[model samples]
Every structure is written in C-alpha cells, then in structure tokens.
Target: MDRLSQEKPLKILVVTQYFWPENMRINNMVEGFVAKGHEVTVLTGQPNYPEGKIYADYRRDPAQFSNYHGAQIVRVPIFARGQRSLTLALNYLSFFASASTIGSYKLRGQSFDSIFVFGVSPIMVAIPGIVLGRLKKAPAFIWILDLWPESLRAVGVIKSPRLLGWAGKVVSWIYNRADYLLLQSRSFDESVKQYCTRAISEDRLVYFPSWAEDDFSGAAPVASDLLQRDDSVFTVLFAGNIGDAQDFPAIMEAVKAVKADLPVRWVIVGDGRASQWLARHVAEHRLDNVLLLGRHPLEKMPALFAVADALLVSLKTNEVFEKTIPGKVQAYLASSKPIIAMIDGEAAKVVANSGAGMVCGSGDALGLANIVRSMGALPATERERMGLLGRRYYFEHFSKAILFDRLEVLFRKATLRRSDK
Candidate 1:
C-alpha cells in the first residue's frame, strides 16, 4: 500500500499549556500536522510564558478561542504567571485544574485518534491528556521535553525527599498510564523505563528529539540597526531563556576572561527571571563587551541569527541536564551557525558529533573562555565550514520533515493499538 493508504489521516488533539503567541516548538508540530491533512485542535492556556504577564489583547475573553494556521485553539482560564514562585506554582496548578475541568467539557463529544501532550515542564500538564484519552478511548501520547521531579530538583524547586517521592509517584502514574512516550533525548529512555510499569511496554518508549521550526531554515537579511553591532566585531549570540538552568554567570565569566584578548562581543537575546540580575551584573562589572538585547518577538530571531557569527548554549552542571538537549541547539544548527555548547551531556555530544562546534564542561568558565578564544582565532572560512556541516546534520537528522514522518508513523501505531484493544 502507498504511505497515505497505510497510514490514514488522524484527528489529533494537542494538549499543551504553551502555544502560539508564545514561541514554542509545539506550534511547529501542530502546524506540521495540519499541513499533513490531519485535523488538529489545541487545548492551551492564554498567552503568558517566559514573561509572567499575558499580552494586552489576549487579556480579553474574545482571544480565548481562535484559529491559527488552520488549527483550532481552545484557551482555558489560567492564573497569570506572576514573577513569584508561589504565583508560578499557582499558574501551573490553575492550568491543570482548568484544562482537566474545562477541557473535558469542551471536548466532551469530540473524538480524536490520539491525545498528544506537549510535555515541557510541570508534568501536571499531562492530566488533561490522560483524562481525555481515557474518555475518548484513544491513546495518550506524551512528548517528554523536561523530565519532572528531577527537573524540579535540578532547578532547586523541590528539594525535600518526601516531596520528591510524592512527585515521583505522580510521574510514575502518568508514565504507567501513557500509551506512548516520546522523549527528546536518547538518554531519557532509561529514566522513563525506571518509572514505567510492566503494563507499559518498552516499545512504547521512543526517542524523538525536537526540530527547529520552519522559520529557522532560511537566511533572512537583518537590518543593521536591529542588531546594534558594527560589522567589524565578531558576535557570539545566545538566545532563549536566561533562567537558573542556563548558568549565565559562567558565560559572563567566560566573556570577561576573553574580552581583553579576543575583542569579541556576547549578545544575549531573551528574557526570564534572571534577566534583571544578568543586566545588573554586566553593569556592575563594567562588561562593555556583553550586550543584553532583551526579549524580541520570534519573527525577529531569523534576522538576529543572520547577524551572529557563532551561537552559544549553556546549562548548569546537573545530572538532569546531562541527559537533556536544549531545544535551541536544533535552531542553532538550522541557522547554520557554529555552536559553543557549555553543556556537559547530550547537547554537547550532539554538537561534537555533528562537527558543528566545540564543547566544554558545564560551568567551566576558563574552559569556555579558551574555547571562545579558539573560535575567535579560527579562520572565517573554517568557521563557516563548521556551520555548514552543522546545517547538513540538522537536515539529515533534526529537520521538520524527518520529525513529521516519524510522528506520522507513531500516530498510526498508537491508533492501531487502540483499535487492537
């Protein structure tokens, strides 16, 4: 049979707390599904993400239900994520509550072939997917982006052993119930298997890494004014969340160590809880070479990438992070920019394997500084060659087309399993 005949189009409902207007990889996945002739509906919260506050327009009720790129989006009521940890926890719980209650009501009569949960943070988000999947007699597929409890511990969120044990039980419950688990890193398989029961077959666990969104594929000419950099200076750009996990202090130290000798500039292009502290630290240290560009819209990322010579990615030294691959690595590879990965595990391995960039141990400021100086010393053509190789690797392994093909097959398998039961 032909591919389409063998794998029929599916009605896929994506459950995610974050979506469009909030620049997440899930947006790309939903769009890809729609492009493949599948009916896609998104159950998500109002647009309030990296920034704690919701957008002004979305604060109104009319913004709750809308269609984007041919996918139906149903927004539930969520407590706005304030800057405080207590508020953030409330924000997560509120979404879990609303998504389970309101989502069940909204999707009561709807039938879907599979419930795909974009599991990034707070595994609690999977509750609705699990509930709805059971209700509809469909398979629940969870794409594990961040492993919970361990992730919480890594970020110093939940330190108590009792709380960790409770969280682990909750995680194991979700894993046991999930019909399929898609992991972003190969190393995640063992961690997931540890929690899964015999009822959850090992074959259901799959290694499925993220891909750069369609936008990052091509080069866009950036206006010089937007970058605020002279053509003479080499720029090493780091984009995405500036949270505790990123260990930006180490990056700052690396910049400080090399500033006198290399004359390269460091461009940080995102916002988070740590943004204010990073800016203040730069000012306090008189680090003129470091420029905090603040948060820009997702559309501007291509332009920003155009202006950058090298891309930087970092994570704190943690066992949890060692098995994790930061999503931005795919984007950096797609941008065809040589990477400097100061992350000690899977992310670093990816960069090294792709021959796209150099890697240093996480939080190793001196080692990162030396790598920076070495990258600066390399010939422009050599650096460009590295970037080209990275781009080739991205297309070969992490392209959207490759991901979509794999997901199509997985969806077919999930639906087939449901029917077999």
Candidate 2:
C-alpha cells in the first residue's frame, strides 16, 4: 500500500472567533490544512474583525463564504463589534453562546476525526471547543493565541482584583478540561501551568508559532498613493490593529522628539479602539512626518510592505505582554524589511536574534526616538543586509509548510478518535 493511503485523512472541525475576510492567522492555517490532505471544516462567526463590521461582500452573500480552500465554513450568528466597548463585549458573548448551542445543533448529524480550536483572545472559545468535542466524542485541542485575565488587565479592560480572580477561575476551567493546549510562544508554558488547577502533563503543551501567509510572499509591489517612491526620507511602516496594547502614546512622544531632527516618515495602516486618540494627538502635535492611514484590505499590505524602508512593531509595557509575541512580528520578518520594535522579552528577542533592526524598551519615548535616529542614519547596504537576515529567519523558523506538518502530527496523535460519521 502507498504511504499516503496507509492512514485515512483526518476530518477536522476548526472552531475560531475569526476566519477568512478577517486577516487572521487561522485563515492561513486552515488553507494549509486543506492542502496537506486533511478534510477540514471551520466553525466561526460573522467576518467583522479589525473594523468590527461585517465585510460588505460577506453581508451581501453568505453563500460565497461557505467554502474556503476546500474546507467548509459554518457561521454562527453574532452581533458586529462596531468598534465600541459595549458592542465588542456583546460580540464576544454572542459568539460563545451561539457557537455552543446553535453550532452544536447545526453539526448534530456530522462527526469529526478531531476538533481543533483556533484559540485567540477571549478564552471563552475553549468552552465551545470542549462542548462540541464531548458531543461529537472527539478529542479537542486548543491553540493558545492569547492569555486572558492577564490580557484583559494589560489592556485595562478589567482592573479589579476580585473580578480578575473570577476570570482566572474561568481560564482554569478551560485549561483543566482540554485534551491538549497548543502554545504559540514558548514563554506561554509557565502561564498555562499557573492557570490550570489540574496538573497538566508536560506533553500536553506544544509549541506552535504563527506562520507567514503564502499570499504575502509572492505579491509584487503595487503602485498606490499610499506608498510613494521617495529616497530623500526614510519611511517606517506599522500595520495591524491600532489598539491599546500597541502603546501608541509612547510612540507619539517618540515621534515628536525625533520628527524635527530626522528625515523619517511614520506611516501606520489599520485602526482600532485607539484611532480617535491617535488622530487627536497627530493633529495636536502637528507631527507632519506621521501619517495615519486607516484600515485597508489584507491584499494591500504586501504592496505597502514592499515600498517601506523599515517596519515598526510595538507592544505596551506589561509582564503579560512581555511574554506574548504579537503575530505581526512574523509578518514583519517575512516582509524582508528591517524591523524597529518597541517591545521587550519574546518579541524583542526574536527581532534581535534575527538581526532584523533596532529595538527600544517598551513605552520608552526617548529610547524609541534614539532608535529611529540610528536606523535613519544607517547606510542603504547595511539596511539591505538586515532585511535579508530577517527574511532568512522567517523562512528558516516561521514558514507555514513546517507548522502545517506539526499540526497534522497532533491531529493524528489525538487518540480519542470518534467512530461516528
């Protein structure tokens, strides 16, 4: 018998809070899973992500999104986030409730070989993962994308100790029940142990880092008004959500200090809860070099990266954040652009080890300004070398092909194989 035919293709149900049209890592992972000979189905919510409103195309026709890269997509009803606290809170709650009940009813007749949870923020996703797994008699594996309670505290979403204690219990509940937890960062190991009330086996936690989307690697530079060819000034681009964890206030302080003295342009793509504050500060300070281009489609980012001189990634100063590696770090390395990071710990370590570019202490305005000055002063050849080193790092360590294979192994390793179909 052929090796490929020795084992059957595992039927996987991927439960996530975000999916295609949302520009998340899960979308790429699902596509890679389909290509690797797995029968995959995605369980997700409406496609309102960074902007918090359903995409116009998705709104117009739901049928168009039913299948992606040979994997079927099943959507549950959830209110759009609308980019507000009240709505975002509702958005989180609605998905949890709907996905657990309605999602189960929808898939009642079907059986899956494995249940994989694309665990991002809001650990409530794990509850449904466990629920559906029990109903289907299949083992559920959660890919830890964000640490809750700590993430909530880091963003000032919830500050009370007692409430945070309650949240901790919620996290402990999910960690205790999951068959295995996939870790996106090695540093997350300690955090998982602290949260779980039960003693989890060492084998339960697996290192599964984010991978670069294949869409970006082949896209050529597209001429647009957003990315103008200019050599007189160094352009630094920052893409992704403009949320609280990004520490934009500190970046603004740094920009104010350096804009007068350095020939550097700061271009930020995408917006979030912090958009208004960023706009106000931009206008108030008259930081002419800084440009805030609001959110754009994912397809446009490759072109934006292509014309940029360097990429800047920032995270706030917090112990939880220090342990976290923002997904953008992988994309920046893949862009082959020298990186300027205002972060510490894991993300900073990656940038430094990759020889990407300069690093500044988190929330250090003075340090950020100095790093910008140093990067602006570098010779073109030196910058090119840095870009190449970062690209090499991405290909060697963060390629999708390598990660998809690891995912496949875990799927097969799951021993509680459900007999139902």
Candidate 3:
C-alpha cells in the first residue's frame, strides 16, 4: 500500500491556545503535520491573542467540531473579551479547564497515534495531553514557544521569585511527561535541557527555527515609496510588536540622537501595549524622525522589509530575549534585507555566523546609532551583498521545506515506535 494507504494514517491531536487566522508559530506545526499524510486535529481556544480580543466570527459552541482544510479543528471558549488582567489569566485557565474536561470526556475514548501541544499559558494546556495520552496510549510531543515562569519573570511581568519557582516545578512536571519536546531556538533548547533535564533528550530536543511562506524572487526594488523616498537618508525599519519585550524607547532615543546629523529615519511598524506610550514619547520628545504605522497584515511584511535599508530586530535588555529568536528575522531574511539586530543572545550569534547582519547590546542607543551609521557607510554593493547573505543563510538552515521534512521523519519514527511497542 502507498504511504497514505498504510495500515492506518497517524492520528494527531494538537492542543494550543492559538491557531490560524491568527499569526502564530503554532500554525506552522499544524499545517506541517497535516501536509505530511497525518490525520490532524487541532484543539484550541477561540482566536484572541496579541490584540487580547476574541475574534467576532467564531460563536462559542460547547461541543464545537469543524474541519480546517483536511484537518479537524475544535475551538473552546476563552474569556478574553473586555479587559486584560487576572481576567486574561482566567481566560487561559478556562481553556485548560474546559478543554481538559471536554477532551477527557469526549476525546479520551478516541485512539490517536500521538498528541502534540504548544507550551504556553504553560502547564494548564498539558492536562489534556497528559490525560488523553495516558488513556488513549498516544505519545505526547510538546513544542515550547516560550519557557514559562522564566519568560514571565524575565519581563518583570511576574515579580515573585517564589511564585515563579512554583511555576517552574509545574513546567518540570509537564516537561517530564512529554515524549518529545521541540524548542523554537537552540538557546532555548539548551535552557530547557538545563531546567527540565529529565524531560528532554539531546536528540529529541530539536532546533527548528520558524519560517515564512514566501517565494524569494529577488531583492525587492529599493523602497522608493513616500515612506522611504529620501535619497539623502538611510531608513532603519523596526517592524513587529511594540510590546514589553521590545524596547522602543531606546530606539526612539537613538533616532533622536542621530536623525539630524546622520540623515537616518526610524520607521516602526506594528502596534501593541507600548505603542501608545511610544507615540506619546515621540510627541513629547519632538522626535520627528520616528514614524509609527499601525499593525499591518502578515502579507505586507515582505514589501515593508524590501524597502528597508536595514531591518531592526530588538528586544528589551533582558536575559530571556537572548535565548529567544524573533520571528521577524526569517521574514527580513526572506526579503533579502540586512539585519540590525539589537539583541545579545543566540540570535545574534546566528546572524554573526551567517555574515548576514550586525548585533549590539540591547538598549544601547549609542551603539545602535553607531551600527546604523556603519551600515549606512557601507558601499551600496557591499550592503546588497550582506542582504543576499541573509537570504542564503535562511534557505540553508531555516526553510519550511527543511523544517517540515525533519518533522515528518520524526513523526514517522514516533508512530512506528509506538506500533512496535
């Protein structure tokens, strides 16, 4: 029989807090599995993410079931409507509580080959994975998009170290239970290995960077649009979330320091909690060179990046950001734009090794300004070569084709092992 007509198509159950119609890394895993001849089912909550508002189209159905493309989809209720505080915590908790109840009651009886889950809102989502995997004899695969309490604590969002330590134990429990754990970055993989030593193995903890679905034709023609028409100036583009992790204040300050002298313009695209603060800061500081555009759909990123003289990928000066890889780096590489990464971690290490871009200490406005000046000073051809290097680096190490191929092989191995046992 053909691969698709084998003894049985692998049945995969994915538990996540976010999904399609929402721009998230988890979507890639869902789509990757579905395309690889697996019978995939995604168990997730109604769409509400960076915006912190539920999508209007999906009305709550207590026992909802639908199909996305060829895969099954189940969306549970999550209270993220009006405010964001403990309410948001409750919202995430609700999905865990509800999905655990509904999945254990309704899905426990269904046999699946494997369970794959995104680890965020951390341990709560793991209940179904642990319960269903135990009952149905399925192997559990966990994808860590962010390390839990460590991430929260790094951002100063969760202050109590003692509480964070408790959260870490919960993370440890879920990690120990997973059959396989995939991290978004190599640095993250190392960190998880340190904390949850028993849960992950050297081979099982894979490093598959995220990717964008783009056909690279060539470098986008130099952005001559009104937003970037100044032939006399170099424009540094910072596009993506302007939230806690991204220190936009430093970016604005860097722009303010050199805008007049170096003929540089700072263009910030995308919006988030700190966007209002950034706008107000710009107004208050009379920082005219900094321009803010509201968040655009994902499709627009390549074009925006194409026009950028250089792309800025920055994170707040924190230890966590070092271990974290920004998704925008892939898009910038796809656009054949050189990166000006203001992050000092594995991401910087990767860029430096690729010879794609430059990195600096996070929050160093003078250093950022200096790096901006250095890139601007490069000969036009030299700059273009650097951008090309970035694209080549992306294709060699982080393309979707490569990542999905690796994933398919892993799934096959996992399923075959389960069958043998």
How do all models score by TM-score? 0.96, 0.94, 0.90
List candidate 3 segments past 4 Å from native: 1-8, 60-65, 121-123, 197-200, 215-230
What digit string (tens of lDDT, one per residue) describes model 1 on residues 1-421? 2433474579999999998888888988888889988999999998888678987767675545478789999889898898898999999999989999998898878899889999978999999999888898889999999887899899998899999999999999898889899999998988888888556666788889999877788655455456865567779999999999999999988988898887898899998878889999999999998889888877788778878889999999999999999989999999888999899889998999999999999999999999988888889899999999999999998988988888888888777766767
lDDT of 3 at 61: 42
Worst 10 residues of 2 by lDDT: 412-421
Ranking according to TM-score, highest score first: 1, 2, 3
Residue-level lDDT tens digits of model 2 in 125-182: 8788999989997889999989888888888889999999999999999989898899
Question: How does model 1 fare in lDDT?
Answer: 0.88
lDDT for 374 in candidate 1 is 87
The per-residue C-alpha lDDT of model 3 at residue 19 equals 78
The TM-score obtained by model 3 is 0.90
Tens digits of per-residue lDDT, candidate 3, 48-167, equal 766677765554643333666577887776777346678877877888887787756756457787788777655568777776777777888777778777788887777988898888
The full ranking of all candidates by lDDT, starting with the best, is 1, 2, 3
Reference-based TM-score, model 1 = 0.96
